[model samples]
Every structure is written in structure tokens, then in C-alpha cells.
Target: MRYVIAVAETGGFTRAAERCHVVQSALSHQIARLEKDLGTRLFDRTSRSVRLTAAGEAFVPVARQAVEAADRARAEVEAATGVVRGRLAVGAISTVAAVDLADVLGRFRAGYPEVRISLRMGMSEELIEGVRQGALDVAFIGLVPGTRPKGVRVRKMAHGELVAVVAPEHPLAGTEQTDLRRLAEESFVDFPTGSAARRQRDAAFEAAGLTAEAPFEITSVESLAKLVRANLGIGMVPEAVAGELRGLHVLRVRNAPTREELLVWNSLGPSPAAAAFLSGLGIDPSERSQRSGRSERSERSA
Candidate 1:
């Protein structure tokens, strides 16, 4: 029943397998066996599409109620017994999580001591996908600003700007502010393509109508700063990181485009432990009003 629900919720077998943490063949076999026992087909599959058959449409609601009722019963029993024990999967970008995660985790541990917290770190795009597929209970990510996945919910945490970092002896290091386009031809150390950090860098350059010559691509903000300090190339990094990396000069750029940090989750059917974890963050999972700010530009993925 849970596997069927996952398949229905995610819209495809492959995604359902990922969410359930099972091999596709195993999930298919189990679901097929389930259908055989029920003596009716549950899904109609084709090369490009999958949907419920007429009998499936009639059966799914009952199956969903059974799954949801069992979950609620388990949550209620845990609450009544004062034993909060379930796994909570959380994902985040390394840099963003550094802001207040230690503190959040500390408080969360105190509140739900029996809850097993699993922390996974990755790029924002992948993190968002994790939330969409129900692999992660919640995530902290950087986004440009726009529509999110159908069932996932989003709340803005911060809307902010990043500054340029250069070697201490570099010309722009001593300057209070620099024109963004002036360094178009300079060697640059930047985030690799398809990463949220890279997207921000690319968007800023495109907004200014200047081509970036970032031949040195990287993923870690720390690594990017190290390269800048070595005088290999200048890089753009968050203000928090700019303040910390040794021998690096931080320069404010004129009208630098901003990025947003967001908390993404699916509140409707989150794991019991995950829901408790959200409460510890001062987030009422069901409250959309928890979202704070909006970027002026179009929205991107979490």
C-alpha cells in the first residue's frame, strides 16, 4: 500500500523506487504481485505516461486511507507513550547550513531526543530534487525565486548579496566598490555549471551583458576562496565566507544581483520525526506564512 502510494504521489515508477529506497525491479515486482492478488490492474503504463486504471481509481482512495491511518496511529502511539522515535532526513547546501544549523540541531536534539536525524549535504538543485521525490523530509537551499514542485512547500529564509573576493594585492582588493563588468576579461574561479552558486554568478554576468571568463570551475566556496587567495583567479562568494578566508580581499560590487535561501518541505505527510523537527525550527509545517521575502527576479529551484 505504501509503495503504491509512493508511485501515485511521484507520478512514475523510477521516482517511486528512489523515494522508497528500493530497486525499480523490486518495486515493480511487488506492485505487480499486489495487483495480481487484488485481481485488477492498478496502473496503466505506456512509453511516455502512467496513470490509474478505472479499477485503480476506485481502489486508490481506500488504499491511501489505510496508509495514512496506520501512519497516524503510529504517531499517536509515540506521542502518547512520550517516545519520539523515527528517522528524519534533512538535506542542505554546506554553506547555507553553516549559518544556524548547529544551533538548530542542538535545539532539535533536546526537543526530540529519540528522533534519528540524518543530515545530507549537496548542491541546491539536487537538494530540491530530493525534497520533490520525498527522499528528504526538508532542505535548505538557494533559489532564484518561482514555482516549486506540486506537493512541496517553500519558505524564504534570506534574500542577500554576495561580494567579490580577490588576492590581497589585487587592484580591486583595496577598492570599496567595483563595477561588475570591469573584470569581464579577468581570470575567475567560479562554481561549476548547474550548481546554484554558478547560476547566481552566471545570472549576474548576463544581467550586466558581460561574458564571464571563468575557466577555473569549482564547487566548494572554500576552494573558490583559496584559489582567489593564491592569486590564481578572483571569485565571488557569500559575505559570511568573504569575512573568514585569509589573505583575501572582499569587494562590494555596484548593484550586485541577489540570491535567496529557502526552506523546502512537504508538510502534508511528513514523517512523524520530521514534523517534530520542523516544530523545533519554529516552523509550523502547515503554515505557508512562514515564508519571509521574495526576490525581484523569476524564481528558480530550491
Candidate 2:
């Protein structure tokens, strides 16, 4: 049923297998067996594309509902067992987390002491992928506004700005509200190319009608801070990360972009632990169900 939902959502067996993290052959075999047992074809396949058969259109909604109901039943059972206690992997964008992730985790620990929480930080894209692939329960990320990825649900958390960072002893540290073009001639140690911080930096440069070259790309915000502290180059980071680095001074950009922060999680097949975490955070589960229902409706009417 999960496979069927994935197939319908993604529109191809190979893509569905990727979403489900299974090999294409294995996913295909399972669907074939299901069809053989049900005595109807679920999909129409061609060399270039795949579409749901009429039978598939009839079955996918029920399949999605079944999968969601099973998840809810399991979560309810676990909730009744006592406290919400299980391992949960939580991801955050390294530079900015709207609610002070450590504080939230501390409170969550105080309430559900038995729940083992692992926090990992990286670029928004990578962390979102971690949540989508079921490796992480939830994430706080810098999301592009007005866009939501399939297979997960997100809520806008906050909009915050990035600041140019330099060591206190560096030449640019004393300047306030510096125009970004001033640094166009300086070396830059920045986030990886596709990271939210890097994108904002690029936009800032464009706004200034200048280009800032990043000769060194670091994945971790801490690493970028260290490099900047060592006089490697100027660094661009969120205000929160700058606060953490000793002696790092923040220089404001004239027209820096405000990051759209979001709290995102896998809605399709949330584990009991993930569901509990969301509930504890007061996140509504109905949004996911509604989104799923809409997708299933679209597929059914196709």
C-alpha cells in the first residue's frame, strides 16, 4: 500500500522505489504480486513513462488511507504505553533554527526523558532530504517561501536575515551596515554552493551589482567560523551562528535576504516517535492528511 501510494504520487515505479528506498526490481516484484493477487493491473507502463490504470485509480485512495490508519493506530498504542519514548533523529539548518533547537530539545527531554533525540545540522537541502528519506523525524530549515516538497509537510516558522561575519581583529569588523560590494575584492569562505546561506549571499551580490567569489566552501557553520577566525576570508552567516563564535563580529549587509525558516517532517509514514514529537510541539497532524487526501484525489480524477 505504501508502495502504491508512492507510485501514484511519483508517477513511476523506479521513482516510487527511490522514494521508498527499495530497489526497482524488488518494488516491481511486490506490485506484480499484489496485482496477481488482486486480479487487476495497478499501473500502465511504457518505456518512457508510467500511469495508474483505472484499477489503480480506484485502489490508491484506499491504500493511502490504510497506510495512514495503520501508522496512527501504532502511534496511539505507543502513546498509551506510557511516555513517548523512542529514538528520533532531528535535523536543523546549521546556521539558523527559529526556536533555539537546543532549548526545545531540552524541554522535550524534560517532559519525555526516555525519548532519545539525536540532533544533526547541515545545509537546508541535505537536512530536508534526510527527513524526506525517513532518516530524520523532523527538521528546521531555511525553506524557499511558497514552495513545499511532496512526501513531507512544512509550516513557516520565521523570516530572518544573514550577516557578514569577520573576526574582531579583521579590517572589516568595525564597519557597520557595510555595502556588500565593498567585499567583492576580498576572499570569501562560504557555505556549499546550493546552501541557503550561499544563495542569499549570491542575491546580495546581485543586488549590489557585484560578484563575490567563494574560493572555499565549508559544509559546517562552525567550520566556516573557524576559517574566518583564522583570517582565511570573510564569512557570511546567520546572526545566531555568529553569536556562537568567539570574537566574531557581525557586519550588516545593506540588502540581505531574509531566510524563510520552516519546520518540516515526513508526513506520509511518520513513525510513532516522530508523531509524538510533533504532537508535543503542538504541530497539527490534519495538514498532512489533508495534503494526502488532495494528492489522492488528483490521482483518482486523473
Candidate 3:
């Protein structure tokens, strides 16, 4: 169609060939083959120039329209198939995966059976970097205040209340809720010093005029929970994770800090499969609007 249109518009074989960046003979052959296929002469040949016949004139507009429509339809199909059948790489913090991500992914897989989903677990900072570098399509991370990386979008997926956890036999375990001062006295099983969780914990202690002195530092939440279960120390953890401790008692904090569980992704945009998977997990763009409204309401009330 392009070749035909060029020839019609140029009104000469040599000019059409020049416009199409093809040799004149090749253009002539292509037009000849096209005419043969249609069983009609598409051009009237004269020694000086070429002109469209009545049949050619009638067919040119319809041919161009058909070609344009076919091209658009092909593009749309490719975009849709890209969404339906591709790999979506995702990352999550270990605790989030244990608490709720597996179920979300399970539902996503059931809906998009053709999409291959790969989930990696890592620290929140690492996951954020992964999404920023295009290594991950999206991630579930512990939210950090004032730490948004450039070219990445962050959405809060859930809010978790903080809780103090201790071994069942620990003295403070029997309390309904404990004060920060009392909780600070015990040895702590802590996240890495610079971690988002650790930052929040430190800020909370600072606000309450107390300090956490962890004898040991462990990066894994599962390990931190286990250490707490062994009477190693009292640790602050998200309620979702604390609820999973079998032999530990999680005490509510009288005024502990809360953390947002966030979904982070590159600003470059999502593949069709990734977008569909996110939608299936109920984390569509509208969910972000709803969360923002709730946060605003909470702030106004506070």
C-alpha cells in the first residue's frame, strides 16, 4: 500500500522509486506483481509519465484506509498479547510475603494463567533500588518518610500498627500494653541500623525520650521473631508479623508508631502483564486515590 500510494502521488515510476528509496526496476516489478494479483491495471503507462486508471483511482483510497486500519489493529493485538503472556518480576520484604503477598500472588496467577510471575524477597531499600534499576517491575516495601527515590512511584498498600513482642515467659509479656520506657529496658532484636523499620523504631524511641539498646542485630524479621521467642530480648515488629509468632506474646504499645506497607515501582510504567497482575491483586491506580483520601481523613481527625 505504501509503495502504491507513493507511485500514485508521485505520478511517475522513477519519482516513486526515489521517494521509496528503492530502485526504479524494483518498484516497477512490485507494482506489476500487485496489478497481476488484483487482475487489473493500476497504472496507465506513457513514455513521459504514469497515471492512475479509473480502477486504480477507485481502489487507492480504499487500499490506503485498509492498510492503515490493519496496521492499527496489529499494534493493538501486540499490546494486548504483551500484557497477557509475559514475565512480571516482583520483589517483597520477607515479612510482607509471609503476611499477605503469597495470597495476593496466588489470586493473580489464577486469573492470569499465562503470565509468569517471579517473586524475590529482600530488604525494603534493596527492593526499592531493584525497581528503580528495572530489575523489578514492582515491590512491596516498608515505607520510609521523605525517602522517595527519583523516577519511582510509591503507593501505600496497607498500614500496620506497631507491637512489642517478647517471649511468653518474659515479665512484660503479661501486660496488655507497655510503655516505651519499660520496653526499652530489655535487650532488643533489631533491624539493621539504617533500615526503614529501624529508622521508625529509633524515631519513636526518640519521641518518647527512650532508647533501644539491642545486644544483637539481625536483618531478617523471621530471625528477629525467633530471637525474641528465645527470650533474647523484646522487639518491636509489625502486628501482622507478630500475630504469626506461635510461642511469643505480642503486647500493644500504648503509643507506638505505625508503618505503611507500600507498593513501589518504576515511573517508566508497567508492562501489560504487570499492570494486569497488579489489577488482579486489587492494587490498581484507584486504590492509591482511596488510600490518599483515608490518610487525609486520618490526618484531619488527628
The regions of model 1 sitting more than 4 angstroms off are: 1-76, 146-150, 289-302
Instruction: Write out the backbone clash pairs for model 3.
Output: 83-273
For model 2, residues 57-121, the per-residue Cα lDDT tens digits are 99987786577557556656777886565667899877665687788888777877766789998
Residue 32 lDDT in candidate 3: 89
Considering summed lDDT, which 10 consecutive residues are worst modelled in model 2? Answer: 293-302
Q: Model 1, 1-302: lDDT tens per residue?
A: 87888888888999999999999999999999999999999999998878989988888778866765575578668867878776677898756833488788778888887777789987887777777666687988776544233456777777778788889889887787887777776888987776677777778788889877887887677778778888989887767757777878888888675677788887465667777877776677677634334433334543
User: What is candidate 3's lDDT per residue for 70-109, written digit by digit as tens?
Assistant: 6435534666655365667899886672236778788878
TM-score computed on alpha carbons, candidate 3: 0.66
Q: In candidate 3, residue 45 scores what lDDT?
A: 94
* Residue 271 C-alpha lDDT in model 2: 64
Model 3 collision count: 1
TM-score-better candidate, 1 vs 3: 1
By lDDT, the candidates rank as 1, 2, 3
Q: Candidate 2, residue 16: CA error in Å?
A: 28
RMSD (Å) of each candidate, 1 decimal: 7.0, 9.4, 17.6
TM-score for candidate 2, residues paired by index:
0.67
Give the TM-score of each candidate: 0.69, 0.67, 0.66
Q: lDDT of all predictions, in order shown? A: 0.76, 0.75, 0.74
